[model samples]
Structure formats: structure tokens, C-alpha cells
Target: MLREVTAIRYVTPLREGGSLPGVVEADDLGTYVVKFRGAGQGPKALVAEVISGELARRLGLPVPDMAVVQLDPVVARAEPDEEVQELIKASAGANLGMDFLPGALGYDPVAHPVEAGLASRVLAFDAFVENVDRSWRNPNLLIWHNALWLIDHGATLYFHHNWPRAEAVVHRPYKWDDHVLKPYATALATEGPALAARLTPSLIREAVDLVPDEWLDDGGKDAYISHLTARAAEPEAWLP
Candidate 1:
């Protein structure tokens, strides 16, 4: 399970995407970028964040430490914006938090060029989960201490949003034309398959197991397990 922490202060909003996740100080004396469960996409987005981010961590990728942040409505008093206050009240429970990188900068491809090995693995991982957010215009990536770190995976595993037709699109081809890292995935054909082969069912399950129960929409955990297990088993169909 991911570490659990209590948010003590509402620092400020990150304002990256529509969700408006914010920076918060936790009882652990650590700061984190908290993804509110009450945001527009609902708990499912948090679920994707935990499951996918954890998977990246397990794959020896550079990702921040994650925690389940328990929020209390009392903190809303510190927020003046009516909109932000509402968001705090709504997310008065468990929200996903990622350790904040103090000096990290938004990824600029020109500034931090990726090697073919790292690029191919990330591209393969994103393709496996059908993530459409890692584009050149909005690369969900960061550069901290001169190393690339993956972030904002809340857009992955979209099939969970539409269960009935999820199977139909399991083998869907990824639209890589706009993927920011596609240009560096020089060894995708070989690197992609090598990475896919390592995603055994047990490995995937380890990541999914971190999600809390209430965050799951009735039988959601089982659905995720089934879909991802199947997807991992058939990499030839989805790995770009």
C-alpha cells in the first residue's frame, strides 16, 4: 500500500489541467501535489493515478513517492476562492498525493533530450494504457535533478470509463503522431516488446492492489484487473 498522510495545510493550487490539483503540506512534514478525488473526473482519475504511477515506479522508472492524503474540510477556511473552497469540501477524504519536486521544471524536449531506451519504455507504457496526454503540447513529464520523471497519469486506463466496449478497444492502435517522446523511441520495435514481456500478471496486480476500496466504483477493482491482465498478456496487439 502507498504511504498514508494527513494534509495539514492547503498551500496553493497547481492549476495544471482541469482538475486543479494543489500543493499541500502534510503531517509528515513533506509537501505533495494532491490530486483531489472530488475533481471533475471523479475517483476514477485518482484510481488511474495510483495504479499507473505505481506501475511506472515498479518498472524502475523515475516517479515520486505517492501517498493517500486524508483531507478535512476545516482546511477550506484557508482558501478564499469560492471554487477552491468547494473543491476542498468535496475532497474531504482520501486524495492522491505525489511528493513535490521543489526545483523541477516542466520537460522541454530540447533541454532534456531522452535516450532511445528510456523513451521507448515510456512510450510503450503509455501505449499499453492508452494515455493520450503525453503529447508535445502537454508532455506530462518533468525534469528534476537533471533526470526525467513521469507525472499526471490520471488520463490513463481510460477503458474503465466505458466498460461495455472496453474489450473492443483493447487492441486499439495508439495515435503516436503527436506523442512528444515518439521521435526518441528509436528502438520501439525491440525495446517495446522487451518491456511488455516483463509486465507479468503478478507485477500488474501489485500496482492495482494499492488502490483503496471506496475509490473503486463497485466491482471496479475486478474490472481493472481483468482488463489490464488481458492487455499485458497480449502486448503484440497494443505495444507500439
Candidate 2:
């Protein structure tokens, strides 16, 4: 389970992407980027974030610490923006909060070159999760303290958005042509298998277990575990 914290203050919205996740101060005196359950994509997006982010962290990838943020109505009542206030009202309870990186910059291929082995691992992980958002135009990565960090995994595990089609695409090949790291992932043959091997059944289950219960609707938790476990088992089909 993720460390739990209560939102002590609602800072301004980050407004980086469509989900409209905002920066918040929590009871632990830590700043966080909180993704609300009331966001357009709802809790499914939050679930994906937790599972993928935690899995990446477990695999020795750089990711911020995550916590379950308890949202109180008092914060909603103080919001000047009606839209933001409504969003808060809708997501009155538990939400996803990630430790804020104060001065992190968006990843740029030119300024921050990724190593071949690391790029291959990131590419392989994205393929395993069927993440379609890691394109050059909208790379969801950050550079913090000269280290590459994975972020915004709400766009990964897209299969859960349509359960019936998930099974159909279980063995689908990942299209790496548009992947931002594809050019740098020259060691896929060696690095891909090594990274994929780390995702044993227990590791996959551990990642899935991080998702909160309320976020899992219609046995979505089991579906996620099954889908990812299956993908992990057959890396040859998806590894680029």
C-alpha cells in the first residue's frame, strides 16, 4: 500500500496536460502533484499511474515517491476557481499524489542524451505496458539532478480503457517507430530480455497490488494483473 497523507493545502494547478493534475501541500509537509479522481479520465487513469510508476520504481527506474492523498472539503470551499472547486468537490476523498520535483525540467534529447542500455530498458518497459504516449512530441519524462525520471504514466496501460479489446491485443507488437527513445535503444536484443526477465509474476503482482481498491471497478484489478502478467510472459511479441 502507498503511504497515506492528507492534503493540507491546494496549490495552483500544474496544467501541463489534459488530466489537470495540480500541485498540493500535504500533511507530511511535502509538496506533491495530485491527480484527482474527478479528472476527465477518472480513477482508471490514477490506477494506471500507481501501477506503472511503482513498477518502474521497483525496476530501479527513477520515479517520485507516491502517496494516497486524502482530500478534504475545506480545500474545495476555498478555491477561487469554480471549475477547480467543482473538480475538488467531485474528488473529495482519496487521490493520487506524487512527490514534487521542484526544479525538474522536461526531457530533451539534445540537452540530455540517454544511454543506449537505459533507453532500451525504458522502451521495453513502455512496450510491455503498451504505453503510447512516449513520442518525441510529448515525451512524459523529466530530468532531475541530471537523472532521467519517468512520470505521467496515466497514459500507459491503455488497454484497461477498453477491456474487450485488451485480450485481442495481448500479444500485439509495440510500434516503436515513434518512440522518442527508439533511436537510442540500440541494445534491445540484450537489454530488452534482461529488463523483461526482471518482471517476474511476483513483481507484476506487487505492482498491481499498489492500486487502491475503490479505483478498481468491475474486477479491474484482476484484469490489470492478468493483462500485464501475460504481456510480461511473452516479451518476444512486444519487445522492439
Q: TM-score of every model?
A: 0.97, 0.97
Give a tens-digit lDDT track for model 1, residues 72-117: 9797586888888888889998999999999899998887789999
| Prediction 1 global C-alpha lDDT | 0.89
Q: Highest TM-score: which candidate?
A: 1
Model 2 ranges with Cα > 4 A deviation? none
Best by lDDT: 1
Q: Mind giving the per-residue lDDT tens digits that candidate 2 earns over 74-147?
A: 87566788778888888988999999999999989878889998998899999888788899889999999889
lDDT of 2 at 10: 93
Clashing pairs in 1: none
Off-target runs (Cα >4 Å) in candidate 1 are: none
Q: Each candidate's lDDT (Cα)?
A: 0.89, 0.89
148 in model 2: Cα distance from truth in Å? 0.8
